[model samples]
Target: MQASQASSRLGQSRTSIGTPAAPRAERFRLTGPSVRLDPRIYAVRKDIADIALADRVFAPHYAEAEQARVAVPSVALREGPSDDARAVSQLLFGEGFAVIDSEGGWAWGYGLHDHYVGYLPAAVLGDMGAEPDHVVRAASALVFADADIKSPVVATLPMGSRFAATAEGAFLRAENGFIHSRHAGAIAAAEQDVVAVAERLLGQPYRWGGRGGDGVDCSGLVQTAFALCGLAVPRDTDQQAEAIGEEIADGAALRRGDLIFFPGHVGLMADGETLVHANAHWMAVVREPLADVIARLQPEHEKPVLSRRRVLP
Candidate 1:
């Protein structure tokens, strides 16, 4: 399902940002017109192909993915390699990207964190330097030219941004600038509650495909919350509902951390009766009674709660 219309909950949050691994394409090749692939996550075009899919797909050229990191605070991965193209998702600072091809100032590849494939401006990426040792845990963090807060703000990063840094007195020295140590947490530092991460992002503007503090959508909000805790989740709602957590049998009682699904939509349960979600209807992240959301959504859209999946013990 399209992320713009669907709802999904966050994934499990772990303490450490794990290593960025390349996507392992299937070993067997499928020959013929019936070979089906999801274009959203597979970097295959009529002329170019991700090396991982070389054996499974036909292309005149196949290239191995080069490791790259986002140098800018955030950049949009678009439908095409142009400013006018639709942004499928936003890549946060320090997120890993596997570049399978590049031309005319655009890089074609997929995100290492979620494997979403798209075109991004080539200028926003840099050589992957040191492995990330920390993640931005605050809703947003400012990068200062100097250790002091009064220094010029060079950049701003959304939550879930990762980086490698050294402690410089009371501040952390990142490649871009110094950030207050309090704004970041060690990659291994796990937040115990997933709901707390979602609550921290309340009031963010709802943007389609936005996954961080600058802007966020339904699934983006959930994905960002989990990423901060060091977990990678699919970028869209249908994928999230199909892959994340176990299905709760029908008529089962609801609990915190349950993924509440509607027609092309998903939300996280704050409690049995409360839900937190980023919705276009409200134009922002909102927390309210589950009953109120259901009442409003059902009449307006003719969609009811479809399923509830439990993601926490």
Candidate 2:
């Protein structure tokens, strides 16, 4: 009749089960030989049944943050809206939870918590604490793997810069290994996520080493924030440009979040014709007319206009 009643009835006539008691035991643990229950109380009763069988149940007031310390390891963190971004990152998948689960291509998670629910793959979760709402300054390279603070070119981070998440092998053991890194982290990222997440930081700030929303740079701005949100965009605009979608030669057809790029620089297309970026040349993060930004920085024919990223499900 009702959902609970149906469950109770189904639990009783589990002919497929090896024993009559097995169905009840599988669904719940509260009811005993002498007990029967109203259908409305089936779920509550079942919970008690499971607990009675277990060695222990959770403390009534256990903190979510504490509980999160042991949540099902984050098996995946992919890009796109909460619908179709199911593609997985091979290296970083199944790494374990770093911080809270926020939003995804298909679903949104708690600020920094996970449940017993199995929703997506291992690519969705970033390394522990790699993605934090609040940020701290980087004294050294924040070395994660084989790296030291002396080589800023390797990690590409300046001293006293703030960052979001650091992986163990991604940033330190760089494939190119030419871009000298002062800090070495094992942050294994998808490389394409930097541009995707960095687009969110447009109009923020162009701090030399600042990575959070407070301030960011051409490369640091893109690389760090994406890691915080469980995406991994590249460190530079050129390499990142390749990762995004086709070129938007004209700003008229550009979408809201489309990214615009210039020689050695990048910005985002905001509203009708606004470009958002932390302009080092201008010394502040602000919005400009799309036409003007393109005319000033980009070439007439090859003006890097639209670099759309498909990050939603």
Candidate 3:
């Protein structure tokens, strides 16, 4: 949609995320004066019904002027084809993301984390990459705009370089003998059609409420991952478990993307056999055999097993 047209729609429309619902067809008219988003400049999953649901769907500038950094050494990656919301960019750090874009259930934002600067699904952000300075582990890889891992020559990534963030696909789902864990902090990559994205972040840093490339949490990790894959995830473990539509019996045929929860914490499994997440004990992201981790965490609660809901894209 043209900016002028979008503005006109914003002026005429009244909407919100938590408002009462209308028939989905009455939402927006792309052919009308209502501002439709630019497919080239920004895009959400086509399955999304409306763009007017957001206050601001896309913009050339950051909605608010702010400087933020990745607080954690590693955070969730989102799903975006553009530089704005591609896997992991540094732009989300303390950047003021506008609610201009939409992808069905998700919204988009812009930030310094994404040097390319554009709209992305809003759901990928962990509290909008809220930050100051980001945390970086000793051996960290900071991906920049002009990055080329396939290239033979590239500058060495310094330990502390701020890049832009694009999107967070899905929560990391982990498994143990009969338990599931989704370590959002352990996620490394997204947008790839993998069975388990959480296992990819095995050995990432551990940061609390830290959703940057620096550090992240169990819930943050899960929410971040699903955002990239165009999945909407909640920020807390309990809330996340409820989003799973499919539930596996304790010992059912275990697979990837299954969530594992503990009494006070949660994590994700990369595969039926291995789990991934950051830990205060491990001090970083790691993958443990599902059966072993379950045995360790199971003894804590009378039945520490809370609820397992399957939330996948």
- Write down the TM-score for model 2: 0.34
Local error of candidate 2 at residue 122 (angstroms): 32
Better model by lDDT, 1 or 3? Answer: 1
Tell me the tens digit of each residue's lDDT in model 2 across 1-313: 1111112322321222223434343322322233343221111122122222122231111111111221221123233333344522111111233221223322322212211122233234333533322122232233223444354442332322223343333343322232123232223322233334445444555665333424566545544544544455654576668764565554346665566666677765555577667678666666678777667655455745435443322
Error of 1 at 267 (Å): 1.2
TM-score list, all predictions: 0.87, 0.34, 0.44
lDDT of each: 0.81, 0.38, 0.43
In candidate 3, which residue ranges exceed 4 Å CA deviation? 1-91, 94-196
Give model 3's TM-score versus the native structure. 0.44
Tell me the lDDT of model 3 at 63: 20
TM-score result, candidate 1 = 0.87
Off by over 4 Å in 1: 1-34, 300-303
Report the C-alpha lDDT of model 3 over 10-75, residue by residue, as the tens digit.
222224323343343123222224346534224322333124322334322112222233323333
Candidate 1: worst-modelled 10 consecutive residues by lDDT: 7-16
